[model samples]
Target: MRASIESEDRGNSMKEQIKYGDDVLEIELPDDIIVDRVAPASHGGAKACHSLRDDHAEDTYEYLYGKIHQALIHASTRIEKCGKIVIACDDNTRVTPVKQLVPPIIDFADARGIPAEIIIAGGSHRKMTRMEREKKFDKAIMDRVEIMDHEWKEEAVFSNVGTIHAGDESIPLLLNRIACNHDSFLMGIGNIVPHSVAGFSGGYKILLPGLSCEETVRWVHYLISKFPSEAILGIADNPVRRTINSVHQHRKIDLLVNTVLDGSSRVVSLCLGNPITAQAQGASISRRVHGVPVNTPGDIVITDSVPESVDFWVVAKAVTNTKAFTRKGGHLIVFGPCDEGLSPMHGDALKRMGYDAPRNIRSRVKGGDIPREFLLEASHACQVGEVMEHCHLHLVASGLDVDAMASIGLHVITPARASSFVRELIEITRNEVTGRKPRVKIIHRGAEILPLQ
Candidate 1:
């Protein structure tokens, strides 16, 4: 039988409620016990390694899951018989969502006679195909964690009470059903960002996608990630901010631990305990350490140290950097650090454009009607050699065929010689042209050419 809630500290409680974004959870504990769980977004790489260490010192020498295991151990150690513990985490195969990290934790928790239920938190969110879910979260966690039925539940919302102000808008937070509660410390482990909702990141959000249903998740994602330019993943005023506010109201999760990332997405600093306070402290460090803006563009420009991800896809991200600033044909110099190959979409597009790539790319403008054979022929037309011959292409590559570029009658330079060549080109252009030197553009890491006028 389910237990009913009763308040104990009626006289001493100041305000009976508080706000998180748009939602408000109770100020007084509904029961004598309560537990809040938050699992943050995971971007695998070096940053995660550093982030793990900084947040939990005892587990600093331990790997990512080591701390997670400790949290489980702590929760299990404290909760008595019938006392509840809720764990929210990503479906990542390696470190979370219980199956991978829990067997040991669960076995430990179970041994202590504490029963636990796992809940999938996505509600009305798009459901992951079973296969997709299985691949991401191993069967072990899937089996033990109680997957919340996202489809049938009433919409989750925050109570209207105290609100956080963002510009002119005021978001409301509301109380929701009690999932689990305990007197032990409330723990939140994850990364933080300037989200569209929940003001700064780190808090109630870890559970939505981490535990929610696929359709519920998909629906929310569609809204949050809608306009790419208007809403970056970690930017403000995006749908996520509103949603975050709507669900987590005045929960006052005890501890929020996170990492600030660097340019290579490395974790340069760590923030722990109390998101309201910790987020403010970490934001400063993030800006100073990893927030270098792209350089201002000039006419004929060369970009150095561009991310290799630029060439990985047909949709080049360079347009976002300086495509508008660059003048057509006016030489955009690219520096390469790419040992990895180009994006398949990009390769396919090149092939369809008559470049000699293996895959046939269908034209987006033609609505996939262009035959594959035609695409192959077009692929042949835009070969690297042909592009160099027709357009004023200057290539500086480490392992690329520089001689082939020279044979095609275009300027070619080895990686080492590029700086001098650029310097000479600048000198020659400045001498020929009168009024201020024509802008010379240089891109450090060149992958794909963004055709921006």
Candidate 2:
């Protein structure tokens, strides 16, 4: 839920309830902090993300379901004879409405006496636990189908599909064994949103980096680091996107389901058709819906990583999305309720490396000081490091080590009380004159919201 909130002066401070994941949190700002504005997860004109909720949810759902059903009907010849199908879906990191949208395909298959299994497109992220899976899909759907996840570490499970470029270097493009099965129909599912690496999320992403082998995942991420994020973030078809679309040449997926969600996590619109065309169609609406106008960059920008996520990895997204609004040499406050702690899969690699600028990391990797094994982690570092170049980042969250993050250029701060962290943070970062107030902007759903100047 988005927060229809405005900052209110409360004597010596200001208080406002902004979107904190699926809930709202009352953030008390010190008197010295000026709340210049607040942006939200889903946004367009009216104010923030909360104001964009589509109250006619039932109509929207029925409409999208019917649309998807129609597409499935056309593919009946193959779907009916196949006996089994594979459903590709994004992991929990995305707020995709999998529970609501996925069932249509499953039901279609079941009615035709066909079985369906779900493959979690985890990318290089860790496996989604049963609890996360439940949250990601319909509870009942879990019992009816076998759910599997992409294993980036297991070389044996992947089949070398073809070759894709990381830069000038050509790398082996590998996909899962099941994904290689051309006999069954594969339905790729995800929501479209602005993204730094892929231009926009969904489409070919749910297949290439989503279920690709370790080498493919690193190649995709590494290719993106070579471009400035501003060029890719919300662009319909950038170079990064064009390169990713190349994967479709190898894998012949029958259909793709890409939906656009409002700030309230309700369906705004959905595109169901060829993966490339559908993603392009959905991204157009996504750009229009998610693009929030920014008056000016803020002296202090506050962004949040919602609860129960992949820790700093999720926080890195919040940082990437919100960094554009932080004036150079300004402060960027990261509000992360990281229940999963620092990346469970890449924590060791992260701890060993610092959040150096992208060029520095690039130079070290080129010098062969940093090995190729941590290529994906290197990509993560470069994304986060890009933000550090423009602002002084202060990470305020749980499930993180203070000294560990501090050593990597992240100034970690935690309050004795959760409610006091923001206020205490303001006091500690008082770089201005004693009587001066600093301008602040709060990006409620920092990981998904896009700010347009």
Candidate 3:
């Protein structure tokens, strides 16, 4: 079952509760502070396939594999003869069920006497641990195919694939050597969800940020700072996505198996064909599933980054997604259990750069002030800066210390104190606006939903 908002009202006070990690956070607000509209979570109904549960008999790996095999066969013309195939799978941050997706592709390759391997497209994030691998993959599949993680720092694992000169910026394309050397490359990706950078995540993104070297990933991310407002959730034609598509021309993707997931992370729709076309079709479905139409911007927005937890890095998705629905200079509060801090590698870089606003960060990067090692992390800092530029950000994360949150220009608050702090902020806002009640919007699954205009 999908997690949803549960509300309880008593007298003049209204209490709304949402799942935050393993616990529930109760948000108490005065009736006036609450808005009539509370965005619903995208639980794509009974028509969509549910996750593998005892109640559902058809949600088995055998059924999923049949769908996967048909898609692969229809899209893959030469999978029967391809000597070496590499499967580009998403890292742990994504909810894609790689274990179920990989077996069918491997079976096809094995039948054709082709060798195949799985590469975890980690991008700049740290490598997945043994436990994470076990969680994502089944023992049977793990025993059959070799699985390796992309090492962005290791120079030998990458090869230069020319450069993409987009709008005065020359970004060198250094991709994973294994992916480039394969006779055929197949990408197993989740649907194109609303993303901070690429308009939607999936498609060519599985290559650029997924399997690219640090230089390629950093430069493209830095390019995103140029058009922060345009790079919004639910948009499919943003500058960052255009650049990613341009870079994709350097390498040919044989087939793409993209799945649209419901709120419960079940495979709802599967698209297979040319990577671009399949992803576009999946993105269309994603827009329908996750897009929430807003008649007007909210004065105060409260959201949580659940499921996409473990670090403030992924949790920041809630801020970016909420930014689209917030009024200019309004307060955006995000609460999550960021147990991994900012990020293991990018946290230090974010602190060093400070949240100097997006414009200032852009100028510095343009002038080459950012060090090479920190460029990828700086790109992330730029994203935070861009979000801060549009709204007053308040982050309530227990894993991150006050100093760390402050360093990133976020007002830190504990989960227990979030309601009180927001209540006071709304009261102050209401008084300043001549007793106008604040329009507060609560998003149950902020990271997953796309607030559209």
Clashes of each: 76, 0, 0
Q: Rank the candidates by TM-score, best first.
A: 2, 3, 1
State the weakest 10-residue window (summed lDDT) of model 1. 31-40
Per-model lDDT = 0.37, 0.75, 0.74
Tens-digit lDDT track of model 3 for 275-367: 777777777777766677765677888887756878888988887777877888888888888888888968877877777687787778768
lDDT by residue (1-453, candidate 2, tens digit) is 342324433247666565444446677777745675554444322111123344543465566677788889998998877667899888888888887777788888889888899999888888888898887886899988989988878998898888776567787889888878887788898988778888788898888888888777876787767876787787888877887888887886788888877665657667787889878877777766667766667777877664224588777887888788888888888777565666888888878777899999888888887678777788889888898888888776656778877877777766334457666556665665366566678776677777776
Please list the residue runs of candidate 1 whose C-alpha ends up more than 4 Å from where it truly belongs after superposition. Answer: 1-61, 69-78, 90-108, 121-124, 149-153, 156-189, 193-200, 207-249, 254-272, 278-290, 297-453
Off by over 4 Å in 2: 1-12, 18-26, 31-34, 41-58, 415-437
Candidate with the greatest lDDT versus the true structure: 2
Q: What is the overall TM-score of model 3 with all chains considered together?
A: 0.89
For model 3 the local lDDT of residue 159 reads 88
lDDT computed for candidate 3:
0.74
lDDT of 1 by residue, 1-453 (tens): 001111222223132221111232222222111111111122232223223333433332234345545545554444554355454433221122233344554565566665555434433223446775676556775686554333323345322234443334343332223332434333444544333222234445554433333333334433422233223323433455555534345444444445554433334445644454565465444333322233333444444323332231211233223333344444544444222223322344333343321122223213654443333223222233232332244544443445543443334456556655655655555565576434443332222122121
